[model samples]
Target: MAKAITQIRRVDPTPEELQAQSITKIIGALAENGESIIKMLDIVSQLDQTGILDALDAILKKRVDVAEIMIQQMNQPTMHKIMKNGMNIFKFLGSLNPEQIRMLMDGVGHGIDKATARESDDKKTSLWSLGKAMKKPEVKESLTMMVSILEGMGESLQREKDHVH
Candidate 1:
């Protein structure tokens, strides 16, 4: 027959034991990520050699001043207008179909190339020559497209004017 157990002891790790455990975990991590650590060190060495690390450290030291200057610059009226115009441009582009924009850009690029080639040629264009060009299917198609674009733009301007009143 054995006596009944009455006392239970809870053992706590000493400070030295805790420190050793933490060091062990850190060493294990270092071993597991040796290659990544080496690459990170190489990048840091390059940054230090370029003086970029010093610049970054200086910037961090004066972060509040830099932030204030940026805020002041952005608060100007010209900056506000620029931001508004940029937003409007983005909105207009967002409303357009990407495929249509691609086709228009391609046509513009070809037209620019043709114009550049013609620049070296000393060909003079007369009203008669222009009339002859109008007779060509490609020229007629381009003229029709231009007129359609002008009409659409005029209609939009008129609507904007009417809304303003």
Candidate 2:
């Protein structure tokens, strides 16, 4: 009968072997991604030439200071008001119909152009001329829309007042 052995020995790789293995893997990866590595190097070279790399490095090194300064600036009352107003404007725009806004902007653009042309012609807008303009379909439609908007605004104000009381 053959003798039975119970001891199990594990041989760990030497430091040199591990280093060689890592180098081999890195070389394989570099060879496989040569095109990408070259493009990355080109971008790095351009950034360096423009001094952007140095600026980015400096910013990264002083990130805490940069963050604090930015925070301080944003914490100012004017900044707070600007941010609030911006958010309110965005919210209002989000609630509006895009097509209606587009049409309104187009009308405003045409009106400005017409007004400019009239000014260049040195023409005065008399009451009679205004009455003639009001007779136009476009003018009538615009007036109707304006009155509707004013009515809606008045109703909103009245509702807010009633709630306040």
Candidates' lDDT values, in order? 0.96, 0.96
Off by over 4 Å in 2: 1-5, 113-124
Scored by TM-score, the top model is 1
- Once model 2 is optimally superposed onto the true structure by TM-score, how far is the C-alpha of residue 11 displaced, in angstroms? 3.5
Task: Please estimate how well model 1 matches the true structure, expressed as its whole-model Cα lDDT.
Answer: 0.96
Provide the lowest-lDDT 10-residue window in model 1.
Answer: 117-126
Quickly count the clashes in candidate 2.
0
- Candidate 1 on 1-165: residue-level lDDT in tens? 999989989999999999999999999999999999999999999999999999999989999999999999999999999999999999999999999999989988998999889888989878998999999998998889899999999999999999999
| Tens digits of per-residue lDDT for model 2, 1-165 | 988888889999999999999999999999999999999999999999999999999999999999999999999999999999999999999999999999999999999998888889976789999989999999999899999999999999999999999
TM-score (C-alpha, index-matched) for candidate 1:
0.82
Candidate 1, residue 82: how far the Cα is off, in Å: 1.6
